[model samples]
Target: MLTGKQKRFLRAEAHHLNPIFQVGKGGVNDALIKHIKEAIEVRELMKIRILDNCEEDKHEVAEALAKGARAELVQLIGLTVVLYKESRDNKRIELPKSK
Candidate 1:
């Protein structure tokens, strides 16, 4: 679990990033999860966009993606969801200490 400060730091880091993936009407699936896992392993932080045509709720989609990818859900604003995970081989982000 991420602390409040950690989440805020991640959100700021992700602010300028463009959505690397988009959830469409088909919703979350194994293929999408697989790709997300692979991407997050390298990037540590990533953003996903929820399309207007997506059938599931934005919160549901965000949860599913975060759970599927084993990443932290940093933020879900508007139609975008930010995710973060500590990369084992390619670690990048340094999260703030939890008090």
Candidate 2:
């Protein structure tokens, strides 16, 4: 689990990133989770865009994506979601020690 500081840092780091994946007409699915899991493993932090035609609320989609990928929802802005997950093999973005 991310501490407040870790989440803050991740949010800042993800600010300029463009969405690496788009949730389209199909919405969140097994394929989407698979791709998100892979992307998070590589990038540690990734942004996903909910396409204009997506029927679900942006945050609702973000929550589902986050849960499906076992990732943290750092921030959701407009139609975009920023998610983070520490890689077991290619680990990055170490969390700070909690007090």
Candidate 3:
């Protein structure tokens, strides 16, 4: 779980990054979750864009992706969902300490 401040910081860190993945008509799947888990482990923070044609609701998609990938749901703004997870080997981001 992330603190409010941590989420805000992550949101800012992710602002300039373009969405690295897209959820289209297929929505969230096991394959997508596997890829996301691998990518998040390397990058830590990432954005996923939900296409307008997607059948699942944006919030539902975000929740599913976060749960499936075991990553924090940093932010869901418009159609873009930001996710964060501490990397095991390629760690980079330094989140604020929770008090």
Model 2 bad stretches (over 4 Å): none
Model 3 ranges with Cα > 4 A deviation: none
Which stretches in model 1 have alpha-carbon errors above 4 Å? Answer: none
> What lDDT does each candidate get?
0.96, 0.88, 0.95
For all predicted structures, in order, the TM-scores are 0.98, 0.90, 0.97
After aligning candidate 3 to the native by TM-score, how far in Å is the CA of 63 from where it should be? 0.2
lDDT of 2 by residue, 16-68 (tens): 88898999888888988998898799898999999999988888899999999
Worst 10 residues of 3 by lDDT: 90-99
In each prediction, how many residue pairs overlap at the backbone (N, C-alpha, C within less than 3 A)? 0, 0, 0
- Candidate number with the higher lDDT (1 or 2): 1
How close to the true structure is residue 34 of candidate 3, measured as C-alpha lDDT? 96
